[model samples]
Target chain A: MAGYSSPQEFVEHVLEKELSKIEESESDEEILNKLKGLGYID
Target chain B: MSSAAGLLLLALMSAAGLYFDGGSGQHLAYIGPGAGFAFLGSFLTLLWAFAVSAATMLTWPVRMAWKAAKRRRSLKKARVKKLIFVGLDGYDPRTAERLMAEGRLPNLSRLAKEGSYRRLRTTFPSLSPVAWSTFATGVSPARHNIFDFLNRNLKSYLPELSSSRVNKPRRVFKIGRYHIPLSKPSVDLRRKSIPFWKILGQHEVDCTILRIPITFPPEKFNGRLLSAMCTPDLRGTQGSFSFFSTRNESVTYETGSRYPLQRSGNVVKGVLEGPDHPLVPDAGKLGVPFTIYLNGARNSATLEIGGEKYPLRVGEYTPWVPVTFKAGVAVKARGICRFLLNQTEPDVNLYVTPINIDPENPALPISHPSYYSAYLAKLLGAFATVGMAEDTWALNEGAIDEEAFLRQAWMIHEEREKMFFNALDRLREGVAACVFDASDRIQHMFYRYLEGRADGPLADTIEKMYQRMDELVGRVFRYVDEETVLFVLSDHGFGSFRRGINLNTWLLDHGYLALKDGAETAGPYFKGVDWSRTKAYTLGLAGLYLNIAGREAEGIVQPGAEAEAVKAELIEKLSGLKDPATGETAIQRVYATNRLYRGPYLEDAPDLIVGYNDGYRTSWAAAQGIVEREVFTDNPKPWSGDHSVDPVLVPGVLFSNRKIAAEDPGIEDLAPTALELFGLPTPGHMEGKSLFQAAAPA
Candidate 1:
């Protein structure tokens, strides 16, 4: 919550937190497999 | 990354027909109202971010110097360094007093003893939206232009979202079957007066406002804010949950949609409805196909959606799943929803939460600065973005049970706590405020359990929520120092909605409202009503509109003296209405809006606001503009409690860490109080005084 100088730095920190959750829950391979099933990716 | 350049590229690519295929011969795409805006909005947001960053770097020294000068001037006569408002929506004074007497609410009782606790006067209708609007602007509903949750479209005679209005792009480029919108859609915040935070921002005071009602399409100011009530889901509705089941029953729900799924062996397949496909002409709502693999022996399932598989157990909810709806080759709208596995063995039933605009890449502006929501999502992971995040409608419709609903409510509460604490920890000066709605939602659904003696674990649900909120207050108290001023308050209190009074039915029975010939029951929005002959009608939770000349589309009653006479007659007849079933008075009084509100927008207010007696409210049918056969009926829905009664019966509780000399402080008083705390004078248009002041010499 503190020590961030700019809004961009603050935003990047938040993005890191959000992206970490996605990585923790499901890997890229799992997402790709599911996408293949839905015809979103080959 | 300029918006003009982006629009030019879109036009050129669309003209080239790059993504068009010979699927239906027409290359027309239909984007849902919200999805189209999201695509354009996100692009513009990115461009704006880049511009802002560059501008900040260029003017860093000048900005810093200016801020220092402004801060010195702003804090010259300040009383405190920080002011915090903790809003517990629908926290009743009576309930708090009872819990304090029992010594169950230690923190609140201690705060009351040390400072001040009193009953805060609520708005006429005692509604959250109306009262909170008053709290933000220091004005009545007439000045704020928010009388109820819904307002009638005078032209169409249909109920529309009152606080925010979204308008589609009027000008479009028509090329063959494709209609490309050349202009961006506009979303307007309809609340009339300026919020106090904006005034505070003008004086260089930093404020972090979280989940305050009527703040959707967050206004630009020198502070941060996340909107609350009336913020629509990704689908451009308040909140619409999807229930997938294999049952043959076709039922209708007030707020949610049910999709019948066909199960084959152990596999059940269904399509999750997404935003409309923007590139396809005449295309209905877009759908994301999903597959559920049921493990009947284990009572578990694996739901495969958007190329991701989530494990779900019976009575358990899956974490939010990010969904992408593709409209064209490069056009995709992002949203998120959670999945709850309701049943699997006898009949497969899966519940999908309302698709909230992904905070990381929001479709609409749900926070001030536009990037604030994205920053929160990046900071704390994804959270509920819809204003009314709790699925009260799903529980009321019997789609999800009480336990499932409670879990959802608590999860939302946890998210709010994170955001609230984040603000408090970061903000050393200025104002920090956040409102928790679980207190309101839980009591609305669990008050019935308290009325009747039951040994079920869920019977103590309301009491448990109160205790949890008390713990939250204790945490907040620990964070506050002498330099900070804290205020904990609610917009209104709660009362049981045991019986419903259909005002339309009463009007029909009393010959005030007339329907078309041969119509026994009037449909929603008064479809069967012959407005030419109709004198009055009831449409929202508490509104009663008269068909007056020069106002209504089909005016019958004249305005001025004639309208006054009609209002008087209706009020005299409607007041003290009784329910035959229980032989109890259903309506306590009826308020004439003209008399209660004195502002420019008084004409827009409903002619009469029904103040129902405790334990009674406007029926579901009446709220939807239906004239039912019976005037009185039992409210068997899970949403068994409400505060839309007489304002006197549901006075909200207000506890301040600082002593307040004022008695009977209304919600409107808080806005001016916040200004005065910051050493700023209240605006001339504001109609409220500071709560803390010295007594006059006797």
Candidate 2:
């Protein structure tokens, strides 16, 4: 828990370090939303 | 110790392989059945400690000269020589008024009678982590970035601990079914914004902060600190106790570990679980074998654990017993637990407290100077290092009764009092603040008795808790003088949780949330969720999230106009929602996060905060990301009280031994107040005015 002097510093660390593993996979659900939110009823 | 000195000690410890106790922040895998580790580095750690002492001794004069000059300059304009803050978590103002009128809380009443008392405004969503973070940083929840206890890992749509993150060991050597970690897990604090203590530290103001929630993995500062809430136990869970029974019936308590005692001729045996095997992921948990020999009369027992023997009296708790879990050759994870002999007659029913991470040989970075926790353990005795060590859940689950819970909570309280008072005596200057959770935990478990929901022998528990806190304040009065400023406050207040409002179920019913095909209900973490069709959903206790396209990984709703429209619709429909069972309004208000907060992290905030009415809270199901079939349920659990509601309904109580102050104060204001008392200007980004300072001429 090293001290961060400010929020900007913490944010930079998060975006550049912690969140470097951004997902690239696409969801079929997102495509279904484009087709008028079709057939998602359970 | 000073910040520079603390950093030096931390470096020495890190160099000596005592860097981290395995940064398993809420990672339950490591603390499965038995695995605790330390001895592999104990000799090196000891050697480093001596070397650092010698190095510090040699460097003292020059370092002292520099620090003394900085302190003199910082204190030149100081308004007070010393500032002390006593935090009584969840101490309600309404209850205090009633008890003070009854002459039950003499010390708090005296402070109000002689000085000042005000209803302190708590943070939005009214949670300890959020409220205490604001108190520490003098900022909005968006600024501190601790809006809830659990955060949704957007990629997986699962809940993870929000306060801290412990990355897994990066480098490992695999050999014959074992993965020996070559690197320690990198532990990081997730709470944003600079705490006022860090600011004070920059000004050469030494402070001691103790048991403040959300401060796990204590950061380096120009002061001493012992982490509090969010510090997990050796089993890497929040607080999971173990129960050994001989009923031969398999019953699982949600919050406890259940093990059957092997009984043969009055000799019972059970394995005490520790952390997972450090070198082998699939090796299960490292365990310690213990034997309990029942007395001939079958009323008492003698317990043997960790190569030591102690007599266990019926319905009595044994002193903290040290246990070592062997992970590998020369590798051990040390921990301590208290055994309670519930019964020994017909069967053996023993309750073992959650194994707290050994303070003397912690498996995590729980203190600022690194060795400060061990120092305290050496000075005092082994104290509970697990966050939420009071184990309210054990009482709620009926694993332990009222008396046992009370005894355990009070024992932890005494341990805290010792450390707090020690800090006060030694802190002749700078700031010293300590938060006591007994006030919060006792009320959470016993508020039912106050509400007359369940008649119990400990009906007067809440009053007794308030009295105990008052006695504590009276003791603290002795340490305060003319040059010292004492301010006592609570993060939030308490209320009965009579009904739980499942926002997820409501969303499902309202067609805002959709499940997968053939699914009528979702398991924990939204197992059956259709993320795209789910325009609006809820997770965690205090928030409703919108599945905006760019925000969440599987989001469907478009940001801006579409998201706002969904938020507005949910707010309109949910506000003042009535509970059909109780025939009462369950929700008081709905707050749009964008309107409520303005900061860098506002986008990360929950889209809509559901401010339930005083007697209502987010259902346990909703908090765990489960979509149930029903919207409301009567909360029958022993944890009958909470503070997660409209902030206005549960303002915390504040008492100060000073004559003049603002008519109202807030958890955030205390940070600026502490800064102003030290004659330091509050940072411009801080959204608080000094409580002791009046408004400027408009």
Candidate 3:
């Protein structure tokens, strides 16, 4: 409460943490590269 | 796409993750309630939440006023005060008709008699995720981007989750052999296109969606939503169970792990595995030690783990057991699982259900507003957070029997009912949709009993399940009035899965698909297949894919002429292919996707959708991209019922309180109907028609 300048800021931070974005859509090539780098696939 | 630009973009994403305060990236199901905003103590966090809640209550009037101002004129013109959708995932119309005629499902008969019952056309594949995605978006799989449970990765010739992806954090700090994640992991819902609920919310119409398939990583909307299918367990897999047994033999299952149990007299000990260790890099799966005392005289056992004890009886499931693990410097990851003790006199065998993400303190966002799941957990107690909660794989593996699976399925059903009714009780206006899975799970495991047997322990399970669903509808009717419109629907119907058709094997025999030299059989993921010469192959339940020159990473067939020729060849020969054992045609039809759908993602659809005949489906080995020697095999697994067949033969059922005007309403129409009822025009991208008058409900 002390860190927040206003009540709205505190609420926004809480909701952002709670309902944060879970994923971003990538093209097949990009997804493959990322997965490959993670050693998920050869 | 230069290499330097690609590297820069990746670095920017890592920086963005750090800037975003990313939570639960690849290592999902780790953070728990009271752990977030971790700089503050738990008590301080509670104080913060209370302060926020107090502010919300104090400013409720202002928020409501602002919402009213933002609402469109359609809010006042909405024809219905409430719209309730009851989705029974795999409720077969044929079985429903039989039960209704036999007076076994009286409430369903009442609903049909009062309003109307129609065979709703499902999607081409007739799978839950595909059909339900259509139902939500008012579009086909091409537009919704959900064709099956697994979609093939063109680059690796491997299968990836069709609906979502979890990417690990990019930034990490290392010191003294310990690594600290600077940015949190992320989980992304991959299904493209917007659902009807979001449209309704934009128009200021509230929606409370519960457990709809393909809804994991719940989208932000105007109302509450709890995700369902594709929600991974704490271990970040769909649903992986653990079996601890005293047997010496080692065995493996695609969906679960087996651990050896060491016993001395009455005391038995085993290691229960959890998620990957968060702070330690290169460390394998995390484990927590467990001890069990077998009581042969009493035929019961006492199990202890993580500073808690649970008493387990034979053929009965222990209540959800909390299994906590050390996740970080001070953070602890929590998960819950149920244990079913098999036999003790012979050799102690225990089955622990996949450790579900704790609903109250979930590591992943299973519900929109995130706290909604925690609120429900507090209100209703612990509920299963893992998608596919019934554990059908355990039953199929013989780790648990039919009766045990039924017990677990019913428990989940009851839990869902409580939440659905709670939504109903709280709903003053707008839509409340809840989909129950037991109707699908029980039918999948017990439909074979209906095949040839007259009487058995599980012969009547499907009928009983339908009756229960009917009873659930009866309870839901209590909330309906002239101001409300009610709809009961199934994503797709069910059928027998007796004969497994290995499409890859068929392709191999016809030389459409090829194997490596001296390798007559290919292992899972098509390990022994020679992709250079292979023209076509099948991976997902949807159908077969072609190796086009410009499309696949390793392309052999040219796009314009060669691809079309290969597709035509496969379609001509594979259609009406006969099974040698039963002499019945395995394939009913083969649909070229280009003719079936037109959209931006049409290329994602399998080249050909093989419509299986009744009692035939993709074989167990073939579904995983394995190449078996034979084309047809017996489906020996207990998962004997299926809906992945010709869509026309397995049309889902839709019963409503008002008559629908459309002659053939499909699963996609429901979304357009919801939008129309709320006095909002359906989006131009949607391809479904309004089924009833907007003014009828009132």
Candidate 4:
């Protein structure tokens, strides 16, 4: 948060960090869903 | 003048003299002695040529017409309303003799005593596919090109399971060499090959062939045939029929519905009912609990799952009671669910018999190992790459449970026999050629009995299996009558093998076989091969070839000298290799490829064909194997026995109600004899002479 210039940027950075952590802890099914959300599959 | 021309001139002068003299005898004196003698010689030559031409012209067409007439006469005499050919595969005469002596197989024994029995000499390799193909084609293996189960890949020096057709080019093309057609003809048909069934069919005999092995993609014929490619394993498919009933009301179960039951709540529960579907209309009785006897059906309907259709049928019968359908109760169903409902639109409470696979003996989970012996290592190896890695030393020889395997095999044997005997009872007409494979399969797995391996797993069951087969044979004899001609045959005989030699491996060691860049893959020879030193090599089908000059692609061995030298060297080397324990010769015979293989596909056979001693056999995939020890071990697997040696001793039995002379018969003579028995003329084209006259006592 300290590295970011604006509140919005700081919020975005924190959200991205949390998302990566969540992905790491996700199961195969959850990861599949994430990939589908990214348009990897129909 | 030349002798031939002088003779021609003299004959012409004499003809002119005779013609001028009005065909009178006085013209002979008028021509003078010299002219008369010359004319006589020329006339004799002319007569000879005319006679030869006339004989050649008369032979073929007249013979063919006579044969057709004979076949017709035979059919008429016998008035063959129906003809049945029963093929009992791998039935040994020696065993039959023993069984008869023991008072077992009473019916078969009686048939043998009353009927004429003769031993059939099977085609070379004596393997099932080759022998059965010959039985179908009535031709030798050489003509049929079905020498063994596997054909040799000349380029790779590897063996592949032989097919009815060649998938790859039989020979490699070389510059400036004639493109010789080296491919073997397909075994199904040949100009000379005459199938016995085709003859019967031509005569308009209605025949039904049941369960003859290897008749897949059934041949085109007039007869109605249910090709028995094999006695198919019926455990997985839902071939059985089932039925269901409801009392007083239509309990319509929708075309597609799920019925689930839970202990908490459900409807009226009763025994699961009748055949899933009615084969015979009105086969089902109207009762509360329908009694359904599931007789196995060959083919049936399918179930729709999601957007796709699943080909699942009810395999066998399972008893189930109707349960009240509810949402909570349905959720508990692990497997597929069926519904039981009262009459509604589209028959919601209708009795539906859905076909499905038998849940109990589904397909066996056994898979042949991808790499022989290597799979055993991978399965046993427990550790990562280390010295003789833990996994490498590990052996998963199926937990080494020999007894369990034997028991399972015996159980399968019992079921197979039951099905076979039952099928025999059902068939009233048509050919019933049933094959009993238990004899062959069991022998392979349990030959250790004769090998003095006491207290083996099958010790108790082996004799029992034999006794059971004898009983089954007895059962078959009961149904057969004087009209039936039973052929109990074996493709080949079996013997004990002590050692196996990998011909490819041996060649690689001796540098006779060249490898690619230090790799074991067979590559282009003569490019990196040293032909000067290599004397002998071996390949499949016991084919041995010499490095003859002008014959090989790169012939370093001089023509005449090399052939003899190579043959002698090979014979000495192969014959010298003996089993360490037995000190007996490992190889009994090594035939030269050309000498043995006269078929067009001889080029595809091994260069040096080796016939191992009675007890030994080349491994199934010998070329791809690593020859670590000289002879690592004898066949220690489940298939300890093989029929690659001497032919099996099964003798074919022929019977007829009509009194005929007793004469010795060969397999080839069967067709001609059948024709003669029917009072038909034996076909001139047929090589087999008739046994009719001899059938009568002298």
Model 1 DockQ vs. reference: 0.02
Candidate 1 Cα misplacement greater than 4 A, ranges: A1-42, B1-55, B453-455, B694-698
Where does model 2 sit among the CAPRI classes?
A: incorrect
DockQ for every model comes to: 0.02, 0.06, 0.03, 0.01
Using lDDT as the yardstick, the better of models 3 and 4 is 3
| Residue-wise C-alpha lDDT for candidate 1, range B1-698, written one tens digit per residue | 45455456566665555423213323323234333422243456669989999999999999989998998898899999999999999998888888899999999998899989999999987988899999999988877889988777665566667787665655665554444565556677878777889988988999999999999879999999999887777666677789998887778765677888889998899988976555444666778889999876657888899888999898998988988766655456678999998888678888999888788767667898888998898898899988888888788778899999999999989989999999999988899999899999998888888677234879889888888888899999977889899999999998988988888888888888899985768987787999888899988788899988767778899988888898999989889988888889999999999889787667788999999998998988888788889999888877878888989899999998889988768898999999999999877778778999643456
Where's the lowest-lDDT run of ten residues in candidate 3 chain B?
B32-41
Name the lDDT value of residue B661 in candidate 4. 50
Candidate No. with top DockQ: 2
- Candidate 2 residue runs with Cα over 4 Å from true position: A1-20, A23-42, B1-56, B696-698
TM-score, every prediction:
0.88, 0.90, 0.87, 0.51
Order of models, best TM-score first: 2, 1, 3, 4
Worst 10 residues of 4 chain B by lDDT: B385-394
Query: What lDDT score goes with residue B317 in model 4?
Result: 14
- Please tell me which model should have the higher TM-score, number 2 or number 3: 2
Per-residue lDDT over B12-81 for candidate 4, one digit per residue giving the tens place of the 0 to 100 score? 5445653112223232121100011111234776699799999979797986686567556546666233
Best by TM-score: 2
lDDT per residue for candidate 2 within B387-431, as digits (tens), equals 788877677767789999999999999999999998988988898
- Listed per candidate, the RMSD to the true structure in angstroms reads 10.4, 7.8, 8.6, 29.6
- Candidate number that wins on DockQ, 2 or 4: 2
Off by over 4 Å in 4: A1-42, B1-74, B77-88, B93-96, B117-119, B154-158, B165-194, B224-431, B454-457, B508-577, B592-609, B620-632, B646-698
Error of 3 at B333 (Å): 1.1
- Order of candidates by DockQ, top first? 2, 3, 1, 4
